[model samples]
Target: MTRISRILDADSYKASHFLQYPPGTEFVSSYIESRGGAFAQSLFFGLQIYLKDVLTQPITRADIDEAEEMLLAHGEPFNRAGWDHVLNAHGGHMPVRIEAVREGSVLPTGNALVQIVNTDPRVPWIVSYLETALLRAVWYPTTVATRSWHLKKIIDAAWSETSDAPQERLVFALHDFGARGASSSESASIGGLAHLVNFRGTDTLAALATARRVYHEPMAGFSIPAAEHSTITSWGREREADAYANMLRNFGGPGKVVAVVSDSYDVYRATAEIWGESLASQVRAMGGTLVVRPDSGDPRTTPVEIVGILAEKFGVRTNSKGFRVLPDCVRVIQGDGVDEDSIAAILDNLRAKGFAADNIAFGMGGALLQKLDRDTLKFAMKTNAIRVDGEWIDVFKQPIDDPGKASKKGRLALVLRDGAPRTIRAEERHEGEENLLGEVFVDGRLTRDERLEDIRRRSWR
Candidate 1:
């Protein structure tokens, strides 16, 4: 029922080991005995709790035991000894001061929205390894969330059509095809789901599941009937059509099927002949609707003609309810090569021909995620200031004139004012500071235990 269920089940967790180390790990024992080792242990425990909640899967005792076993198993004599020495140097818990922007806030590039520092002067280097992965995990999600927010703004503006329909207008679904080979698979999943918080149009099911598990977004987009089956079957109908039918039957028809790709064979012909009649009838008869997709073809002519056919030959009627009904009536969705400019052009032509804005939906993929210029959504991380001596130091970029790359050194605080989130450098924070990163874990216990759905909802808001 939940999205996380699609990717990982209880059985999978049961079979997997949490940590892997070498056997006869006197190293672990020795390390655990040391002060630095204790701090590392605390950090590790804290990390596990955060990750467990983030992952939304049970972190069992068996899983932890398995992880220890694996770590010991993989530890060489030297590694074990080294690990023990490293642990002993920092036996007590090291205070970690973390300041981060609220999860949903928009952040600019080259900004230190999050600053993690070891509060204990003795074990500064202890938490270094954790930083890379931790930052890596958080960065992509934030970027995706920001991008999705902008995208929602654009969609809202584009679909500013006057209608006397129901309160609900367009529910967006994002499909992250760029995940196939572009970004890290996990990053793609997280990013796609982040987008769903603001823009509900995403087809990254795995990410959706992750999002649902960590952030409760109930509905997600799927391209099984549109792209998946055909891509798997080499354009053959046996598997493709069967898969489509199965999905329709299982998911309960076209209302569930957001956009169906009929362009695999012939764009117009498929709309009129291939899936045009049967699919439309099946959806309509089931009290559902399908969005006919044109994945390839002249965007200008194909969509307009398809809409015309659906409105004219198919006897589709735009009733007061804003529902277009025809024996072959289905919303037209353009996927491949669709951009803002192209979408604007398509919408203009459709309007000129008396087509209702709600008569079509857009399944955006590569254009929104990958095709945009690299600099369109600028994102980066920079160290604002580092404490060298006892006194807090103010650090700034050498070339202060180039404000874009400048960094405000020291501890930083972020605040939302008048609807916009702003960052105040530590030196500039004359007022009280509001720390963004709270104590997620303390002494190997979860201090903040939130449902994944709750986090998702929060992220969206």
Candidate 2:
């Protein structure tokens, strides 16, 4: 893919923004927030991904020339002189100060997550001109991370209520199967990394690569050898049992785990006869776990029934919490039609059937990555303050028809108030009140380069 000039990474109209600001507008303060929608709290993430990928590269003369040519040809007013000023005065680095809530911190909606202002007084419009790309950088992965974090809460509740499994089990309860479901490789990388903030299981290798390249983690996610439909159905229907045996033989061993998609023909018979009777002894003798995957049927109940059937053959044991669990040799993974609601319902049905949440895990795809939109969290970036003629003034929007669209006013500071995060006027901060927002990016350089391990630890905390 051709690299997009950073100057051209904005809306075409952004080229015209240099002229729209009030005369003598020397400084502009803007903020990004979740104005409240699907989730109460937003998980702040992926800003470092953006800063490292896009902003750190200083714009070149070729970039400015290319953007200027395109913008003029596209009939939008081009700020050639302003681009020249950025190139000459700032040495081609974006003259902006960006502060954000620490990556992986979870904060309530309607509060500031990130704030930006011009570091150079001459380019106040740069604050809002960069909104198109800046907000996209924060919203996508932040929303994905927030969704994954909430799923963790649901699974944690089910584990606590239904089983005595170690808390570590929650780390792999929801696996990332959203790679193919994502819109692009970059989307897969970022969205997949977001899911890894809460869990470690994933088939998205690009995510692990991203964690290493972007966040400085060696290997951030894990996946077991698993079979998909094509690999199973390729073996003739008469040879279905052979397919199950093949997975166990190749991927199974002492202390190892392998998954096999068993719904190629009939999931019921495959679970009952093929895995339970035909391959039962081999599965036990292999000294490993066989994760049976049912890819078609009611995601709410099919895996539950399969677990019951497996228990009928391999037997069951009651954990300390008095919930029944399949023998260590067998478990179920449901990958079809899964989302947060379905996962909760499935776990509820499993508990109702006396099965522990430990008996099953889930694989989420589109709903986990591609199905969400910026409005899913009602995310927005708005200018809240500006300085003109050396005097600071509050800026805001209050549309009569939509009060929810009302934006914040004045320069903001996110501080701990009553043990919770509260957004308030920066000047209202009292002595010793530490603002959670830290200067992350200063004049195109990353002030803080966070590690994935620290981010994961923060999210868990």
Candidate 3:
């Protein structure tokens, strides 16, 4: 694959957007928030991606001209002097800096994930002007992380309600099947790692590359050997049993787990007749686990029904919750219709039908990575405080038309009080340096590089 060089990356209006910022504004402190939408806004993600993709990445004079031309074409005001400043900088590096809570740390409802400021006094507009780009950068990862965190809570609750070994199986509960479904390779890399923050299973291969290139990790996530419909059905309908046998023969054995999509034609027939009856003895003797995946039918009930059938054919043991579970040799993974709402419904029905949550896992595609937006979590970046003249003035926006649009006031710091995250005015909360936000990127340098393992630990907790 050929890598494109000197890509023009800023939003078309980004230059003009900063024009309204007050002149002589020596300091600008803004924040990124989730606005308590759909979830508690646990994960603060994507800063690492932002630093690599935007700040540290080189910009050339030609790239700046391309952006200037784009602004010209769109009939929006463009700041020529600003673009010239960037072009003349060493390697055309971005002049602003980013400070924020460590990526992957969880915060409260209105906690700030990021704070921006201009490192050079002459370029005060640098930070405020980049709001469009910064907001766009963080929202996707934060939304993806938030949704995955909620799903993790659901999975954890289900396991706690059913499994005796909740922690042992928690990380393997949900796998990322969202790579091809993502909007772009960049989205796949960001959102896939966001999902991996909560769970260890994934089919998003580029996420591993993101972790390696951006986060500097040996390996961030891994996946099991799995088969899609094409891999299974290519054996021919008459040779369906051969396909099943070949899966077990190749990927299954002692101490291994492999997933096979079993809903190519008749999911029920495949599970009951072919997998349960025909391959039951072989599966038992294989010394590994066969994860049967059902890709069609109503996702809410099909998993429960499949678990029931598997329990009947493969034998069952009652869990501590008194729900029946198939032998450890056989399990089911549902990879279709797996968003938060549908997933909750499926688990509720599964538990009601006397199947332990451990009997089934999940793999989510488009919904997990691509089907969300800024409003999905009500994300926004607002200028909270700015310095005008020699005095610092607190700033905010309170729209009478929509009171819900009111933003936070004053410069902010995320600190720990009584062992819990508390958002306090940076002026008043000048105690110990327990502020959760850290300076991750300064000017053109990467300051606080984080390992993906550390990020996963912070996010999971």
The C-alpha stretches of model 2 lying farther than 4 A from their native spots are none
TM-score of 3: 0.93
lDDT of 3 by residue, 374-461 (tens): 8887888888888888688989999999876788888788888888888778876865657777788876788998887788878876
Best lDDT goes to which candidate? 2
Q: Candidate 2: TM-score? A: 0.99
Quickly count the clashes in candidate 3. 0
Worst 10 residues of 1 by lDDT: 26-35
TM-scores for all predictions: 0.65, 0.99, 0.93
Residue 145's lDDT within candidate 1 is 52
Report the candidate with higher TM-score, 2 versus 3.
2
For residues 1-461, write the lDDT of model 1, one tens digit per residue.
Answer: 23332112222322222123222211110000011110111001112223444332333434344444554455511123222333354332223444444345333343345455554453333233234344444544544455555544445543555223332444443345556533555655665665555555556666666655554445554454454435524647544555445545655553455456666556666567545564655556654556667767777667777887766545756656454434433567776666656666776777676665556666666554444322343333344444444444454455657555444555566554555445555455446655444444332234454444444455434
What candidate 3 gets wrong by more than 4 Å, as runs, is 1-8, 17-19, 87-91
lDDT of each: 0.47, 0.93, 0.82
True-structure Cα RMSD, model 3: 2.3
lDDT of 2 by residue, 24-94 (tens): 99999999999999999989999998999899889999998898788889999988888789999989999
